[model samples]
Target: MMLIVTGYMYVEPSSITEFVEDLQKLAITARQRDGNLSYDAAMDDPHAGRLLIAERWRDQAALTAHLHSSDTVAFVGRWGDAMRGEILKYDARRERGLMDE
Candidate 1:
């Protein structure tokens, strides 16, 4: 099954820039990981410190590999200081979808 990972980060109103930069690096790294379908990030409410991350992986194993990758380590390390909340990981299922190739 394809996995969709969404995360919400509530920052301390400060460190927004640093957090975003770190997330950008992380998104790129996630996309580079094997079996990763997509990885993207966005800032919520314009100037708001809320950050949202979306990811798609081939399967749980692939997602696990991504979590254990060096990029993840660096991502966490780089943003460790500015992190202010918990990261929630959820398992998802697709009921309807189509793609043209």
Candidate 2:
């Protein structure tokens, strides 16, 4: 089953700009990974310093691998406490486009 992961994190307001920039780069790289179906990192509330992320993976193993990938680890480590946040995962059994018939 596909896996969907979503979450939000609070970062130092001053760092929000750079964080989002770097996150977008990471998302682009992740999408090219073996099992990454999609990846997104965006600012949900700039004033509140809330950053949002939504990722889709082929399975648990793929997700785990991505989590441990060097690039991912480096990105998260760079932000450290400033971006620490909660993430939740779910099994995505199926999906469809809004206009799909």
TM-score against truth, every candidate: 0.77, 0.88
TM-score of candidate 1 versus the correct structure, residues matched by position? 0.77
* Per-prediction backbone clash count: 0, 0
Model 2, position 28: C-alpha lDDT score: 81
Candidate 2 versus the native: TM-score? 0.88
In candidate 1, the residue pairs with backbone N, CA or C atoms under 3 Å apart (3 or more residues apart, or in different chains) clash, namely: none
**lDDT for model 2:** 0.87
Q: Model 1, range 1-101, lDDT digits (tens) per residue? A: 88887877776666777777777777777888888988887787446688777778888999989878887877777776766554566666654556633
Please, what is the whole-model Cα lDDT of each candidate in the order they appear?
0.75, 0.87
Cα displacement (angstroms), candidate 2, residue 44, comes to 1.2
Candidate 1 residue 44 C-alpha distance from true site, Å: 0.6
Best by lDDT: 2
Poorest 10 consecutive residues by lDDT, candidate 2: 79-88
Clashes of 2: 0
Pairs that collide in candidate 2 are none
Off by over 4 Å in 2: 96-101
